[model samples]
Target: MKKAWIIWLASTLLLAAALHVAFMFAYPYILMNAAMDRLSANGERENVWTHAPRMTETARLIVRPSPDLAYSSCVYDLSDGPVQISVQPWGDYMSLSLFGANTDNYFTLNDRRMPESGAIVILRTADQAITDEQRAAAFEVVDSPSARGIALVRRLAPSPERFAEAEAARVQEECRALNAE
Candidate 1:
């Protein structure tokens, strides 16, 4: 009876460990899918920037959003083709970050690293071939691990006045499929 009880306890622990590992591996993908669905719910096309209004207590688009920052998000689907992203500099603090389908942030550019003219990047899947035109465009090319992902832009707007400026500057930010135009 003692040996049987010990074996049962060990089996239960192993099952729990496996379950935990599975959840850990799946949670990021699950969260990202939900976010993508929400972002695209309005029949908006992919690779278009969606500028989010300043985070308010009522805003729930993102988990624990900072009320002081202005945010924009783009749900990119590179299956059709590579996408071009352009982020316009705003204020003293601004950043652009790219995350894969699994929520892995593979690239980030901040104001300090960006040029005065702003930053432009082309995102393509590893298997996608870069065209001569694209190569000659003199833009930074990034190989995405997954064909679908998210690009997020953040700008510090700690005050209402600064938030207004951030909102205005966000107009210049853009993301679009390279083949579209």
Candidate 2:
């Protein structure tokens, strides 16, 4: 029955299309969530760096990471309010990127953006409002959309000989939750 075969083929094609569309929309979010879960559960928790020296070895928190770049990640929880981030411009190429739960990069900073002093400080918060005193003290205030997120630090280590220097720089980066005033 050609008619019945045609109906089945069309229905199957439609179902496949629908499934594909759904997966396409949901894949990024799902991937981000899974990465966050592994990151938070890996005992690093919030405000501490989880170093991944060999990026070729597939990390639980990042997909298709590059070995040429050394990585350090910190999960930030804004439930208690603001957090302090400090970076020492110890290398030629270094970057810090903040990503929210929805996989949006809300803020990013690099060595080139740092002051001549070769150090940078950031006050990050998800609070909708801030007092004048707080604003005055903030060197670089970042207003985030979500209460929880991750901060990633990337340092270029093109070869094994350069890895130690990059690792030293990565270790110098500081991320800590500030005590509420």
Candidate 3:
């Protein structure tokens, strides 16, 4: 039971040294289904529910938008649900997030510096060992993921335009204050 509620933070050292000769966006049905069903079953009717479970992997389901989550889009909200998915803000590298209730352990896709409240995204690289295009988003710089896999977007942030706006406002406010004063 304890194993089903653990989340670990990966180190950046190993993440940087690792070479991505091939990249792929294979959304393991297990991770998505398991997280959805478990969360819905435990949450209110507004949330999504699932019956199937995820495959095996030494992974951690990272990424979230606070613990008030109750829905499932392209990505899973790690705060609630049966398993605890620890999410950090994405600074430089993109990642893939996986969630499983059986071994209920959430972590990054073999990396560190996870996003704080957004989709676990990845960009196109020379990683031939991987094959999921949706994982790579070198083209669709506006959407969630690349091609094959679904890019997780923040529900709080509306679609079709800029991502963060409050920051811009803050900057503008500062400028105005400086000029007026």
Q: Residue-wise lDDT of candidate 3 within 1-181, one digit each (tens)?
A: 5544432223444454453322222244445445444444433321121211121243224443332221122323222211112223333333433333322333234224333443323222222222345336221212212111222222222322222332221122100010111
Query: Compared to the true structure, candidate 2 yields what TM-score?
Result: 0.74
| Top candidate, metric lDDT | 1
- lDDT tens digits, residues 115-166, model 1? 8888789899988887888766735899999988899999999899998898
- Ranking of all candidate structures by their lDDT, best first: 1, 2, 3
Per-residue C-alpha lDDT of model 2 across residues 1-181, encoded as one tens digit per residue? 9999999999999999999999988887787777776877743577666777666655545767787888887777777767767666745788888898778997888878876545444445544455667566555778767777788888888888788887776676667775543
> In candidate 1, how many clashes are counted?
0
Clashes within 3 Å, all models in order: 0, 0, 32
lDDT score of residue 11 within candidate 2: 100
Stretches off by above 4 angstroms in model 1 are 1-17
Per-prediction TM-score to the true structure, in the order listed = 0.86, 0.74, 0.20
lDDT of 3 at 123: 25
